[model samples]
Target: MDYVDTFITVAEDCAAQTGVVPKPRGGRDTVAVLQHRMISAAPYRLTQGDVLFSTWLLQQGVDPATVPPEDPRRAEFFAVDRACLRASPLPKTHGWGLHFDAEGRVALVAVDDPRYADLHDSAGKVVKAMRSSRAR
Candidate 1:
């Protein structure tokens, strides 16, 4: 399987093992939302780096249960706020961040100053494209 499949498998396994519900927000399913409202209100966008990271997570077989509660990756997977973004501390080159809202809607944020133009690409569209590409 590809990296995205691997990550999704791990996340799904983690949810199944923990009995965590896959909450949907704005038709997107996620595990948790960051507490900060400002981050939650932002538009849903995704970057090429975000897609790469998701693929990497899948390939590594990362599981939420295996990730430490304090691990920044956990926050990257779950939280949607500036604090979480700061905490995650992604490389300067990796400017995009992802999170879920209170309603479990998945959203993306641009971390680097003077964000890239493509960062505004609709997350839902990106996700759909990713899924379609993966199916092939």
Candidate 2:
């Protein structure tokens, strides 16, 4: 499933004052790093499903060459409910927001960016990213 005309705001507990680029750790790219790479490089080029699936594939070390876009594997992968962008670390901890266009394409918006407010106000729906920690 994808969010259309929606904006996912940063988590309430997010500490970063502005969007911070995620960095790889332990000589490997973390999920946050992988997600950041994808969305940052091609804003509005992919849907929430595409980003999640692609990241999952990468994490599983699945070769894209072997799994074409039309491959049944894609359908199988999405058969179960998966976490949405509101659960993404970009918004949860990295001070970034996720904006889903009318076509359901997604792009990152820094929390401090003027467009963050613009999109939040103008989007058809708004959802806050999942909190990073349990509420006190």
Candidate 3:
């Protein structure tokens, strides 16, 4: 079933712009991974991603017993903006596009996959994607 309050499909011919885009890695990739896990499993609002990602990072590669709540890095991960996913490498580096459902949950669609055409055009919106470079 297709729902239609917000017509926005993220897939497009980004080939020309792809070269200009930078691959997201390090911390950015970390944020993206967290977001992807949530979205792929179930649609989630951005706030959920922020809290979960912050919490999840602490458990990785460490013993929960010794980890301190006051670690400086905790604040950094906690500060990661959910908008970071919009500019994620999932589209530019990985050739996959993302779109939100009627419920405002994100899902990735392959940019080159013709089967995803149904998701390309948002009836009322012009559509937009993230730029790889910062505005400098």
lDDT of candidate 1 at residue 93, scale 0 to 100: 18
Model 3 segments more than 4 A misplaced: 1-29, 43-84, 123-126, 134-136
Q: Which ten residues in a row have the lowest lDDT in candidate 1?
A: 1-10
lDDT of 1 by residue, 16-132 (tens): 222122244786322232212222444333222333344335446664235444667744744543222222212111233443323333344343323223433422222211111
Model 2 CA deviation exceeding 4 Å by range: 63-66
Sort by lDDT, top down from the best: 2, 3, 1
Candidate 2 least-lDDT 10 residues? 62-71
CA-only RMSD, every prediction: 15.5, 1.3, 7.8
Which lDDT tens digits does candidate 3 get at residues 1-136?
A: 2222332333243454222223346645454454455455554343333334443664375433364668776567657754434455455444555555555445555555653466665433325456555545
Count of clashing residue pairs in every prediction: 2, 0, 1
What's the ranking of the predictions by TM-score, best on top?
Answer: 2, 3, 1
Worst ten-residue run, lDDT, model 3? Answer: 1-10
Q: Measured by TM-score, how close is model 2 to the native structure?
A: 0.94
Better of 1 and 3 by lDDT: 3
- Candidate 3 local Cα displacement, residue 37, angstroms: 3.2
